[model samples]
Target: MTAHQNGTIATEVSHFLLNCFVRSPSWQLWLSLPLSLLFLLAMGANATLLVTIWLEASLHQPMYYLLSLLSLLDMVLCLTVIPKVLAIFWFDLRAISFSACFLQMFIMNCFFAMESCTFMVMAYDRYVAICHPLRYPSIITDQFVTKAAIFILARNVLFTLPIPILSSRLHYCGRNVIENCICANMSVSRLSYDDITINRLYQFALSWTLLGSDLILIFASYTLILRAMLRLKAEGAVAKALSTCGSHFILILFFSTVLLVFIFTLLVKKKVSPDVPVLLNVLHHVIPAALNPIVYGVRTQEIKQGIQRWLKKGW
Candidate 1:
């Protein structure tokens, strides 16, 4: 091809090659099996939890509704990223179209923020249930859940829509290789020939502002819940409170820890292996998803009994 044609193709790059762990072809075979299993586990677990919640009329409450929302978000996240990753690993099909890549980027960015917002709302639900029992019925009604769902969608969509828009506007000249499993905002933006200062700054500011605020609110809600729990005078009240909040706390801890680790790895990308952040990013999507429903099913007695009933009915 002539230099002119090369430049033209680069400028009008229609697709990108995802170099997902391409440095270790042998590892792809090993990674493919486990990733596939995790994907299946996440789908099945979340599906079961959703079905259990739907069928069990007794479980029709704000908390379970929020849990269903979380499951839905997890399933969307997994579906958005995992199938393409598995395809890349198993069949060596690394090419993703330009539009598809940006669409994936949008879903990843938007859904993650939506999940964080959902967690924050769930914390509020728990707060009302544990701290203000009398008002819990009034405050966390089906109407309230519906409003929260709307807020989650609106807030995340309004803020996150621009990430892909900003990223997609940048010009790509000859370099079309993305060095990660998914079209992470930065991973895609960095491949562009255009200056991405605005893109980076917007993403950084938005991420910290959106997710950071959610974390702060969640922490505050739990703090109040803990204070309320400590003031309990009834026998086994504290134990019961702990049991109630334990599952949520565990999921929040894991979610925050993994996200913080991924951010840290990105900050020190120059010092660490390039694949470290990539691996963390990939696991962050699947591990928590697979764990969320399992943790809830095991820790919450209502959910467990509901699952048993669901299974019995299935049989």
Candidate 2:
């Protein structure tokens, strides 16, 4: 418990989602209560979103179908890591084995990749529906959506699985403890005594390619939608069009800020205090999970009515 061959860095990391300083006050501090609430809020909102779509036949259209898929992705994304995250915050700081950590990272990256791909598909779906409403059904069939989803899954798996391969090859001379909350790639890579040049290069390239492409496609679709809305020549059409896009735009902005903040924090020129970076990381994880569902629910009337109906039936 006292010495290490690597260096004199007095680091004792628990193998858990939340790498709280155990020597300090217990992890069940006041802040944790609100985080727990935020986690529950995310789960409930996503569950309500899925239930609303399924219960309403009027919402059985292709647009709602894609929304439900997005909700499902969000649900799975939260479920995969949030349980472990909460466990660390509430219970003991559970240690993540090397394999378990790799698996969690892989799955997290897969869902993130899948979510990005789904947005591109959704952008195209919106484009077809708005730009060519008459041919919406012909252009976006149930069979087509199924095939598209499959392709998205295949592409994400093919590209992202290599991350673990690269990760596994690296050896951890000391305990496999990650700083900050999650087993983030950056955090893990910092510990490696081996070369990480190629891994870092690939990560940079992939982030630029995937997230950049999604943002480009999303903007392109909105441009086309705006053109169509203008051509409609109806006064209310502009308002309605903005309403339709508001939720998706919010998601894009939220994610982009998280990415930028996390990346920029890493690039800070000054002496970036440790706690600041960790809090930024927490935002990247928590804010989206907490705010997204509220954004979607407040913006969509159909979801509100469905929730009301479900509540009435329950009572």
Candidate 3:
């Protein structure tokens, strides 16, 4: 029998069931293999990137510092969502405690926003490096990175803290099934019988405002960068500029594209299989985590050289 509550507040409900593709039990068994592999790859790649940046003196630049921070965020974000998901797939451990669910939701919201902010800052870093080469050192100092770090953390935390807190206060009223692998804001908020329009509207407004602003700024930075490149007569200058910015651009492109796809899937949820959104949601967390390091390792000369040196030393 399912749990029931008489009052408006559903405080009696201790946990919520994460209905991660319950209709297709057998398919989960097969899906678990790839998910597990992806998780491992995401972990290994991001860890390698972090350690490489830390150990290599040559990579001690503002650009690499931001990349290292990106790797850290990617790793934490992947860890936050994927382990519980894999547990659900492998062990049928679908019940998440109320507090744990809220925590997961908080981390996902904050870190994802932080990642977007980091990308915008990184775009600025590239812009300064390419467009104003002589002023790069003075412009992107260690103090600037510290300020940017504070901004990313403070902006995201302050904006997103309300989401989980608001969800926690609502009356669940005994409907505890979240039909997704991860604890999302709407997933939790929708369970409330009370008015959730405020929560939903705030979430929508905050998400677009933060991400949209970052996207606009990043696009403008890159545009100016391209314009600066165009003014240069030497082909070598253009190639050098592209080489430096290419990895960051590619990763941001993938990240933004997948997120857009996820949003589109949400808009057209009725037309597609329910599994599609779930799968996309899960992939959005892991795919970018796995790709960021690999793109940097291959496309980034400094990181590639650092990896080779680290391999030689066998650490």
Candidate 4:
């Protein structure tokens, strides 16, 4: 494309962005401040957790290693989604080009799907630690993690790739403005002139196949873990089991609650208020990423000690 063609695209993008979410309630002005604060806190806390984990040798255990991966994913997930969202809130610039929007969707889904995979792996980790203690190392080998990570990456790529590519091909002359604070899958879908039958069907299948299967496995693992704990005769053994598994429990709760809201709202709610989706988006991304680090850093003794030692050394 010529510079002139590029300029035209830029102008259209600017216009689309300016008008995007313009119909949102003025209450966004009030909400954005608090959300920004939370986002900042989440970023800072998650970063500290990741740094402490990386710096400390004692946290090289399997569970902490997984937690560190989660912390990294958490931070990256927020970094991928939140700044653009904040930009939309602060500047009202939402005119993401078709290509640009698809890129965002692709990256977001990739990290998020990786996160889902991590959660399932985490549940299995807890199960092995608690129920099948002797087999933990052999079951969750280095080869297993490498294979699992590759599998997760491949699934995410396959799942979200079509949504954006299919979406980019659809022409949008009507409803130029995006209703949500950020360019979401559904929001972009809403603006399309083409029938979304295939897209919706894929969405359903991917959710049920990947997410549903993961959730089922999670429940199965947890059941075994709980049963083993109940059978434990010693308090110290229970404490150790809980110590290793406890962080995962918090993680499960955090993910199930936050992501469910977004998933349900996306699937069921039509004509959702612009601000509501934005708020959900913020919570789904920022809060979890930020909270994960803080929860682990504060609750995990080794991480706490590591942070203190670093500080002491600095001082």
Give the per-residue lDDT of model 1 (tens digit) for 1-315. 212433454345778999999877776888789988999999999999999999999999989999999999999999999999899987889999988999999999999999999999999988988998899898899999999999999999999999999998887767889999999998988987678999999998999999999999999999999999989999999998888888999999888999999989989999998888998999899989999999999999999999999999899
lDDT of 2 at 132: 83
Clashes of each: 0, 2, 0, 3
lDDT score of residue 13 within candidate 3: 62
Better of 2 and 3 by TM-score: 3
lDDT (Cα, tens digit) per residue for candidate 2, span 163-255: 767866765555555775666676676676668887788777877887788889888898888888888877787787778777777876776
Each model's lDDT comes to 0.91, 0.73, 0.91, 0.73
Candidate that beats the other on TM-score, 3 or 4, i.e. the better one: 3
Q: Against the hidden true structure, what lDDT does model 4 obtain?
A: 0.73
Candidate order, lDDT descending: 1, 3, 4, 2
lDDT string, candidate 3, 7-119, tens digits: 43344466899999898787688889988899999999999999999999999888888998898999999999999998998889999999999999999999999999999
What value does the lDDT take at residue 126 in candidate 1?
Answer: 85
* Weakest 10 consecutive residues of candidate 3 by summed lDDT: 1-10
For every candidate structure, what is the RMSD over all alpha carbons to the true structure, in angstroms? 2.2, 3.9, 2.3, 4.4
